[model samples]
Target chain A: MKEFSLIDTYFRDVSFQRKDVLLGIGDDCAITQIPAGQALATTTDTLVSGVHFLPDADPKAIAQKAIAVNLSDLAAMGAEPAWLSLSLSLPNVDENWLKAFSEGFKELTEYYSIQLIGGDTVQGPLAITITAQGFVAADQALKRSGAKPGDFVYVTGTLGDAGLGLDILQDHTDVDNAEHKAYLLNRLHYPSPRVFAGTSLRRVANACIDISDGLLADIKHILKASQCGACLQLDKLPLSSAMVDSVDQDSAFHYALSSGDDYELLFTVSEEQKSSVDRVLACSNVPATCIGQINGAVGKVDLKFNDESYAYSQTGFEHFNSGESSNKHRNNAKRA
Target chain B: MKEFSLIDTYFRDVSFQRKDVLLGIGDDCAITQIPAGQALATTTDTLVSGVHFLPDADPKAIAQKAIAVNLSDLAAMGAEPAWLSLSLSLPNVDENWLKAFSEGFKELTEYYSIQLIGGDTVQGPLAITITAQGFVAADQALKRSGAKPGDFVYVTGTLGDAGLGLDILQDHTDVDNAEHKAYLLNRLHYPSPRVFAGTSLRRVANACIDISDGLLADIKHILKASQCGACLQLDKLPLSSAMVDSVDQDSAFHYALSSGDDYELLFTVSEEQKSSVDRVLACSNVPATCIGQINGAVGKVDLKFNDESYAYSQTGFEHFNSGESSNKHRNNAKRA
Candidate 1:
């Protein structure tokens, strides 16, 4: 099929439409009206086959993961996603694959109340690039540089589930229980972006980042940006039942600290705003655990387990780094 | 080097800083304030290594082409370029190549007064996906659907030079004059997007589109969107001296009508607005030629040379179509 017809068949009649969109697809450029008194938050992400995801993964799962990862960036910024521009490069035309991928895109777009404004479909090796834009009120965005020395570190949802899921899929780790395997796989394929939790934390949280590069590496982003250190209580790290049931304590802690692709929000809250943060997260119905405290040591992150200092040495995923053995299973590095 | 350091070394210190940009790199999402009373115009385009440009093409030229093509879409919509999000996938990090690429990017972004907002760099085959956003007054942006039956079709600058350049590069065509060869090669490597001409024709033109897929194919987009037809004066198509000197009349016309990558503006103006359009183009210092007149025949395009019916039978570039032998030299299909 021709590129135009391929797009027309699948992406033309997307279910969600926004009034703010002055012009949608089928144009030289999509025109959108950004709401007054709000700032625009934009991010771009690329998912390469065999690097970000298994080459033979289901089309639906690939589509979902692509959109989810971009939305996760918006969520980390405390922005409500409004528009997405997708550049899809494919090896060849596959009608069934396109149908499933479009269905997956349609589902997430409708659920998020965002519209696919414009994009380009090219002929190349399989890869997907999405640039997501959303609205955040002026001076109200959650940033990594906002943390204070006395702030408490928190995370929404559990960490390392997606990493474990990747391991299970890669056959590096195995789970005998069918339900556990399915749960882990689902977590890997379809991550919740924590949109509500993020927007709720806009005024409450001091600093924020999404954990795509593991808790240890990602929290240091906050420290480096905010110019503060952190003391993480390893025992306090939240582990999903699937993770805890499938792995031993050491493995669970290691994955939780150093593995990537969790898509959970890692943020900080000032001491005075702790109650408010708790209330806001409670209203959003996403469990958030305070696992650490920001300190004055400047970029140093100390780990403590059972009241004694703990030493864990494993770096997060970084593209072009040859040292990480599990880099293939992790989401390739994304700067924004 | 790691991904963060790679981005920091090249992209972080860009010189163009816009006041409307609240936050740029290093954030989960870049924040920008859209000017009041203006709408956002967004478009995305991806260029693969082997398909869009020669795999061994200079890194500087590749970067320039990637940015220019996207800005061409913005210009087609009569939007003033503002921000860009780039997704760059590469096989590996070559510091020298990246330096040249980043320099090319810096030159264009500064020239256009646009800022690089946010993006992702991944480890994959060489490809670039750029999402460009600009601004136009609400309801003032030109569109493909605005042409009337009596409108005069016009095109800016010259066509076919880029195509001839590609043919010469691929050894399919030859030019003996050193200056002409250099000119054609430069045309292929650095086709200028008609930014000034497009913005100037905004209120005067009835409809507009950028000619990337040859004048013949791109004009059909206007025809399809406006529900009208056109009779193109083949003899009136502007051709660069380099193109005319290097090829026969028939070959020049074939390249002008069938080959792609011109990046010139193809637009329509009503009879009453013809003088105004001429004055606008003159002020912008860009030559525009009246090439045709829209007719009521509905999607049927007629070609005329020397006031006689021209029997030209060839199609434009379309991805996944096996019929076109020159598709490899053409820029792959881009919907937006």
Candidate 2:
């Protein structure tokens, strides 16, 4: 069928356009009015099938992840989630699949008090895209470009749990311990977004970023944007007992330092405000660990382990690398 | 690689959680403060490879169309385009592909003067999602429900050209003539957005929609929302000379009424305001034709053809139906 015809059959519902919607689906554009005093924060993301998720992965997980990841972006910016639009590409329209997907999407949306403002759904291989919008007061935002030399670097919660979870899922890691297995699985299946902590950190964080990339790599982003470097104390890396118990101390350290997907916040604060930072994090009821200190050195990140410094070869995850598919890495090593 | 690693490599760089960005990627949410007296009109669309376009379709066109379609949504709302976020899913991190896509994206962004703010990128089937933001004056935006009985139904530009172009691309019909074929192809390749017309209509037209779906189906949305019906004068339907020369009158009528993807503005204005509309259309330099009138009848659309009134079959394009593939329709019949 023609593109327009396809849109009409599957998408053109009057319900898609609401009373609050100044314009909707059929137009060259849709218009909206934001209430005064709200600054608009916009974001977009594309999730490819097979690349972003398993082809047969649960639709609910997929939907939840889509929003969660986007919401994480808003959190980093200290913005409040307001509305979102979704675009889906499917091989075909499976009613059961759509119902499940929408249910999962609505669940997270309602929980967060976000509205499904507008989006387009179409046919193709399974790909989902979402554009999310949030509101925040003007000037109250966290950015990667504001870190200065001598700032104290901090991270919320533990790092590398998601990465460890991924390692566990890639192979049959014989974790006879059920609790440990469940913990790892939970990390993989559901990630807690540090929204509250993020909101609270707006005033204190000189620079902030979420650790979707490994902490080292993500810190590089802040350093590059802020034009500084950092020296992380290896012993200070925050890791869970479960993660440490699953592997050797060295491997656990490696994971905590380099494995990605903790979804925790890595931020820098001025040295004079270190106590205030600690107090704010405590008041907000989230773990905040000081891992390092920013320095004036350019393009260098030092890891001080024991009395000597260790040089790392790999720079965290690179999208098309062939050296170690997590699955393959699991088969070669028995660390977990 | 795990999903988190994929996101970091490809998507993290997209966010700039700066002051204007109140919230940005990596948080549980992002928020924005809307400027005073501006209402936020938002819309989203998803495009999947092989479903929305041929797998080999130009990346530039795909990128351009992705943003253009969302902009079309903003236009439908009679809102001015502002910011856009993109979610992309790709199979591989092919630098060449990304470079081309970004180039295309940047081109249209410059043309439309919209900013690429933030979003996530992940692995999956080639899927693209974009959420676009636009602004309209508070309390003065147009809506579909505003159409009233006795309002003159109007459509800007010609219709059905996109459908015919699709037919040619699918090789469903032999394009014995070149000029007519070029016109059709151009319509499909570069569908112009009627932003000026739509925004202008906000001041005068009772309601409006963009023709992404066929005329009959789209009009149904207005009718259902307005609790009214319409009687379209088939002969008054706008058709290009090329379309008329290529197809018979009846078939041409079918294309004009049911063929979608025109991306032109279909709107309504009060009969008492006809002269004013004419003057406005002339001043705005957009060609428009009055094709019908809204009636008190609830949820019905009738067509006047050859002095005989009949109900439109209400069939054109749909995503789920199997009988009318663009290729099949074009190959099976020389309808246009």
Candidate 3:
């Protein structure tokens, strides 16, 4: 297949179309209009076959994860997803794989009402790089640097389920329940980015980021940027019933604290805005739980369990460590 | 060499700063404000080692080519370069290689006055995916679909030097002149995307595209989109002194007709606007030579040499043919 034919066959007629997209797909550059008083949020993520996903992973799942991860970045900034440019490098053309991938892409793009505007289809190793662009009101963007010392740190949805899901796939842990196994695999393969909650928290949340790096490690981003620290309540960390039932408390907490890829919004709300955040989240039907508090102890993180200090040591996934060590570390968290 | 430190060390302190960039690297997403009345033009390109360039190519050259090619697409759309999001996948971390690569990146971004807003660095087979965004006036942006039957086709600068340069590098062709060899190699390694010529042609040209897939193949994109045909004057093709001096007439023409990566703007100007285009290009000090004319024969291209019909039988690079065939085909017009 020629590059143009490959794009036309699989990506040309995506179901979603947006008014803001002035020109799409075939042009030298895709043209898009940003609404008045809005800023564009741009993010790029690359997924390599062996490094980011197993070689045998489903094309549909890989496609969904690629789009989901970038959209999750936009959601972190309280942006409304608008368009995506995909650069797909394939070792060879496979029609069935392309079809499944396109279907997966269409599903999320339609659900999010975002258009696939432009991209490159190249001949190379199996990898996908997606640059997602979105719009947020000029003054309403959520940034990691906005947290104040008195702010309450909160997270939408449960954490660590995706990590456990990855473990299940790698056979690092076993799930006897067929339904549990399926759910865990789904969690690992398909994550729901907190787009709705993100927009709702735009002006309300003091700071925000999606949990792609684990609760403990990602919160440090907020601390580093805002010049504050956090005290996280171990008992309050939201653990899904699936996770709790599948693993012991220590293992579940470890995954929640150090493992990544949850795609839930981790944000901060001040005392005065807490009620409004709760009300807005409730209206959006997304559960958000306060699990920590920001403090003046810059760059420090304290863990407490039942009002007593808890000692824990583990780090989230870091790329470029020796492949052996990095892979071992990533097998616990698993996506970059 | 963790991901964060790698980014901070190499990409964090890029000198160019744009006032419209509200947030840059280190965030989940980079935020930038699009100027009102301008549509954002976005393009993505991926360069994989051993495919786009030799595996042993200089890191600096590879980096520059990666950014320049994407910018070339923006230029084709007559957009003013603005920002870039880069996704880099590397097999390992080499500080010296990264320093040279970042230096090359810094040179282009600063020269273009564009900002590196965000990107991803991953551990995988070497590949660089850059998504470049620029701005074009909503009504003045050039499109490939606007050529009329009487429009004159023009191309800025020379063609096929890059292809010849590739041949020299691969030892398929030999260049005796030291200066010519250096010039040809430089052309291949450091293509100057016609940014000035492109922006100058915005209101003057009816249709435009950058020559990346050989003039014969790329002009067909305009022909297809405009529902028109073209009669290319083969003898009139602008050949760089380096290209003409290094190869025989037929070989030079073959590369000109079928080789890719010239990064020159190929555009069409109506008869009435031709003088204005000439005047504008002259003011920009960029040589744009008329090489063809658009006609009514939809989707067809006729070649002429000194008013005699010229028969040419070769296609541009197409991905997914057998590796042996495709690689052989690409040797003439590589870079996807």
**Looking at every candidate separately, what fraction of the true A–B Cα contacts under 8 Å does it contain?**
0.97, 0.70, 0.88
Candidate 3 docking DockQ: 0.83
What's each prediction's TM-score? 0.97, 0.89, 0.97
Say which prediction, candidate 1 or candidate 2, comes out ahead on TM-score. Answer: 1
- Clashing pairs for predicted structure model 1, backbone only: none
| Candidate 1 backbone overlaps, count | 0
lDDT-wise, the better of 1 and 2 is: 1
Better of 1 and 2 by DockQ: 1
Q: What residue pairs clash in candidate 3, if any at all?
A: none
Q: Scoring each candidate complex against the real one, what DockQ results?
A: 0.86, 0.47, 0.83
lDDT of 1 by residue, A167-251 (tens): 8788677777778889988999998898889999998998899999889889988899998899999899999888888887777
Query: Which scores higher on DockQ, 1 or 3?
Result: 1
Q: Candidate 2: RMSD over Cα atoms? A: 4.4
Model 2 per-residue lDDT at A87: 73
The digit string of per-residue lDDT tens for model 3 on B19-59 reads 98999999889999988789999999999999899888999
Write the residue-wise lDDT of candidate 2 on A1-336 in tens digits.
444544454444412233444554554344554545656666665666665566787888888887877777677767776666767776776767766777787678767776665566676777777776666665777777878999999999887777777766655354546788788767765677676777788878888888776788788888877888899887888888787777766666667767666778889999778888867777768899998899858757988876478766545664556635533323222334
**lDDT of model 3, residue B10:** 97
Error of 1 at A234 (Å): 0.8
Error of 1 at B214 (Å): 1.0
Off by over 4 Å in 2: A1-35, A322-336, B1-34, B92-103, B310-314, B323-336
- lDDT (C-alpha) at residue A32 in model 2: 50
Docking class of 1: high
The window of 10 residues in a row where model 2 chain B has the poorest summed lDDT is B326-335
